[model samples]
Target: MTSFSYGEFAYVYDELMKDVPYDRWVEYAARKLQENGLSAPSILDIGCGTGEVSVRLAKAGYDVTGVDLSDDMLTVAQDKAQGEGVQLSLFQQDMSQLELPSSFDCAVIFCDSLNYLETEDQVKGTFKSVYDHLEPGGLLLFDVHSLYKVNHVFGENTFTYNEEELSYIWSCFQGEHPNSVEHDLTFFVYDERKDAYDRFDELHKQRTYSVDTYKQWLTEAGFSKVETTADFTSDSPTDKAERILFCVQK
Candidate 1:
């Protein structure tokens, strides 16, 4: 079994994530862009897993380019875009070492993807790379798991999901680093032709820092202004907020 996440998991990603509010994310990005005087701007969808948000943004008339480290995820994203009759420039690349050809009007790393960076330096590098690839005055929008969620929600927790075609046992444990968690997922998927269930496992790790630390890093990476919100709303982040969203201007 592959230890890395998003390998075999990519096949079942969309099915398991059907409840995700992809439209809300797209709306938020569009609203922020319009507020910044960018209408129908070019967008870079960093860590665009399976292209769910990327396809939606393209359908909403934004020029979208998606980049992800996983080839399987990118394959799924490309197929999704083709099925939606939308054109997306998809690339396989690491987010921390991004090197695209053209600058973008806006860049986004949503869905707690930033938390996947285990080290502080990697997160800072991602911010700087994004800053370099964005045009002057361009905005960078991203989100991460709050410290509260990492400690209280995911720490040493076990969750199970069941459906007719799929089931999973997910266990989370405290990682070696502060504000980090390791996820061990065991999946049993129904195979129709074989009339049997195939079992596989994957391990994923995520880490996050305090909001102030993130803000300081963004400033260090050349962002002039950084505004934050909580749980997809415009309200300020409270201690109990689960998701912390950041919008920075370069």
Candidate 2:
């Protein structure tokens, strides 16, 4: 399948993404929330890959519920939550069709998870679904890739990173559309215990929606006020990068 499968990679996800600097993201978001006059008692994380943010929010004293499509990701997330001695609720659910009764004080879709929706309708549906799950005054925070990054920066470049047992090659190509990039990736992993090797390939496609377009969608989803900034640092976007975070109040 093109989507991420739990497989053997589940156990090594955190290690592979060790450079992600998740703590930075949490700290940034927390500061932004404090500045915005919002403090959530409970949070629902949409597309919460492996519950990285979910676990962090739980530790920050918020009841957290994380939802993802990959069973393997959820499995790893559950294990991590338990190992950390923190309680986070995680479930396997499609973003377009979420099934949760408890309305959250706040919801988030971080790490460019919004780009995982492949189509325009899917994106709108996800926004509508998240809108429905929020408390009347709750907030929904999400981010998307920017057009500048796709066209000017990542058009066609390759990077490689290596570890003791597994390594990966990353190649980015500009998509035919105006604001999209295709990531062609390959992974080589060796199991020292089994003395065997395995290879896996993944093609990840990410597209950017204009800032105005996203704000309009949030309004259509019944979000009354929408605020945006170019980066997690709470600065406006420039021509250099393609990441923007949108904060919507329901």
* lDDT (C-alpha, whole model) for all candidates: 0.93, 0.80
Pairs in steric clash, model 2: 146-242
TM per prediction: 0.97, 0.92
> What lDDT tens digits, residue by residue, belong to model 2 across residues 28-97?
6676567667776578888888878888988998888999998888888899899899998888899888
lDDT of 2: 0.80
Clashes of each: 0, 1
Residue 121 lDDT (model 1): 95
Query: What is the overall TM-score of model 2 with all chains considered together?
Result: 0.92
Task: Please state the error at residue 183 of candidate 1 in Å.
Answer: 1.1
Please report, as a residue range, the 10-residue window in candidate 2 with the lowest summed lDDT: 1-10
Q: Candidate 1 — what's its lDDT?
A: 0.93
Cα lDDT, model 1, residue 25: 85
